[model samples]
Target: MIDTEILGWRAALVGELDHRRLKAPSVKLRSAQGAADGEAIYCVDLRVRHPNADHYLTSTELHSVEHFLLEGFMRLLPAHFVSVGIMGCQTGFYLAFRNEGRAGRLCDTLEQILAAIEHAREVPYANIEQCGNYRNHSLADAQRVAREILARRADWLDAA
Candidate 1:
């Protein structure tokens, strides 16, 4: 069985966002559940802003970043990766993974992904054949956001 209290504590410490203000880029573990054979499924929130912040990502920027992040995560952790998706609020992303052990290296892995995005020449899979809104993407915007997130590397693991 899963420990609800522990999960709550983890979310409060690492994922809770102050709704009244803006926040720097951060990666937080939002949830984790055990699966069969001792494996676990984890969902992480990658925030670029606080929940109530008026600012949000443009659709183009979001699409570009999503393309890069989805491709990057898959390339880096193919066996463990589940999905990468944009938040409905447009403040950040949700990254899911399935693994057998503690995901202590998730922050490092995200850093690597962001770094690759920063240097990427194009947003992966942003073609008409691969995306629903293929024309709505901006590699430059994605790189800019990646840089912003990477700049906050030291704070990615900070507790709330």
Candidate 2:
């Protein structure tokens, strides 16, 4: 799952962030547009479709993916990137970094992040460890939910 189409849109959003030629002391993740610092801040918006309306990805599953994605990125992405958290909307993730290098890099970074998410789905709960605030969710459920979310990404994003 992990809708390639919607993923592409997400990547484009990342690309839009990356395309900006920003200055240093950059903002990482921000809730809105405009410069806080010379550095560029990446804005993320996650919109969950039919949240609480359907029994698809339970609250536990969504939070699990949020934690897993953050933990996975922390372990995988370059240290230059900072600020990682789930959107308050409980739909997607947010990541911001001080673009010390370039802009378009966020696209590649996001690709890597997405790939890690897909790979993480393959890991068994017994093998994966908890690294986020909540620990009640399992890797299996996380993977399942990730697949569902990604598969329905268009519907999710369109719902936004």
Worst 10 residues of 1 by lDDT: 4-13
Off by over 4 Å in 2: 1-37, 48-57, 100-108, 121-134, 152-160
Model 1 ranges off by over 4 Å: 1-22, 100-103
Q: lDDT of each prediction vs. the true structure?
A: 0.75, 0.45
Model 1 root mean square deviation, Cα atoms: 3.2
* Candidate 2 lDDT score at position 82: 68
| Top-scoring candidate (TM-score) | 1
TM-scores of the candidates are 0.85, 0.51
